[model samples]
Target: MKKIKYFYNTNTLRYEKLVTPLRVRLLRVFGFVSALLVSSALVIWVYTRFVPRPTDKVMEYRYNSMKENYATLKSEVKTLQDQIAQLEKRDNEVYRSIFEANPVPDSMRVKLIEKKKELDKVEALNDDQLSNEIANSLNNIAARISYQRTSYDGIEKLINNQEAKLSSIPAIQPLSNKDLTRIASGFGMRIHPIYGIPKMHNGLDFTAPQGTPIYATGDGTVTTAGVGNGTGNHVIINHGYGYETVYMHMVRIKVRDGQHVKRGEVIGWVGSTGASTGPHCHYEVHINGSPVDPVYFFYNDLNAEQYDRLLKLAATGSAKSFD
Candidate 1:
């Protein structure tokens, strides 16, 4: 191969020809290109080893932050689960006490037992060992909600039972004060006014003038409010829950059968209409068809001193007939 070169002399303004090898010039160009490639490779390698790329640094930082956040969330969930368990235990104790105080309905008791089983199942979970705190918290929350609902149901049942019991008790005076004057006769063994023989008396007799008011002992329905053979002008009230009150020897009946009567409501006036010796009210309390002392039932309305005095009087009093 042939090569040509030119030289210039500035002072003489002349050109000169020089000789060079074509192979040598080709080799020199190849060498320069190779050196340039090697330098580029060195730069790339240095960048990959030490100088971090923007996208790579961002990705690394994001991964580390995610790990830290996951750890914190797991710890918080564990704490919440512990608190829930404690609250559920306390609720169980309260419910147990309420159940003992007032018997729970069978259906409610079954539901409460089921809720307790569910709580036990949640407590038995060992997911904390596997670091599954989220699952544990979710289960604990569900158990707590179920327990709370069951407790509310128990309370409602207890309230309903108490209300029923309270409704059954006689809480009002059977006769008005105007109609309740002196006692014409006492309860227990007494001489019958009409028969003139020793007999059992199951009620108290109140002497009052005619046209006096007679009140109901409690809220009830007037089952029978008319004259009978021996109890003329009678009023029988069914106060529910195995309690029945009888008002005999009334002057005149004011309420009809099947009439709804409230506490302190007037059913009749005072009178001695039947086998009585004088104008008076015959008040009696029958529990499940058996007569009980009416004075004991009125203890709730009496003060401490009044109740004690009345008890003393009852202990000292003897069966005497007003006739």
Candidate 2:
């Protein structure tokens, strides 16, 4: 503290104490402040240039971690897209095939593709690829679910149509299976029992005792109920949709012309009437007025194996129609 200042006063006598000027003192203070600031700046520069900081390292690590996660998410999104395609494939192959329905229209699938492309564009705009990829995956899942719901709705409509078609088509035995002892004859060429000549049977014959209840095989209106020259007391049902059924050689007809009958309803009773040699019902299934083998139409009531046996039995049968 004793180090003396040396500013001489002009008006003082020789060897007088020196007083510092206000301007010089102010200049010195300004110089000291400038030096302090410069030194502090230098120290800060050296520390930042030579020493590592946790904040910078953490930022870099977070960036790298996010990149790795984004890669994984990208792979996951691709897998989900592949899975969605597979689901669409199955919807067409299995579900649509059963109902004879066409698959989703190309335009619909194209719209879905376009929407995905738009979503991907949005994903690309994001700086964080992981978030983008996750968003894309969620969008893809939601879109596919929506598409699948629409397809399922269409499939449901097709299923309802198929059910109606099934109901309209013949499905059950014209007579009770318990009362049916055997198929006396099947459609195809066979020697006529009464004529003693080969003729197309054009129907199936189920031999039963007289007065056995004969049931209608499907839902329809009776178109004809009268005696045919050879069909005996027959009833012909006009089931719309190019389908019709005939029951012949009945002792009595319970259904009159224009009467509606459901499947398994008693329409007549079996008898040896007309030119029939025995008591049996001549059952026929006509599709578009063309006769198809009646045994093949019973798949609704029989399994594949049982149907195969029945088919085989009809194939090897050698009996003639009683009518």
| Highest-scoring model, lDDT | 2
Off by over 4 Å in 1: 1-137, 178-181, 312-323
lDDT of 2 by residue, 14-85 (tens): 455567789999999999999999999999999899887899788788889788877877776787778678
For every model shown, what is its TM-score relative to the native structure? 0.58, 0.54
lDDT score at residue 27, model 1, on the 0-100 scale: 97
The Cα RMSD of model 1 versus the native structure comes to 10.6
Model 1, 116-154: lDDT tens digits are 986787687654432354456556766776677677668
Error of 1 at 249 (Å): 1.1
- The TM-score obtained by model 1 is 0.58
Candidate 2 residue spans exceeding 4 A from truth: 1-158, 178-180
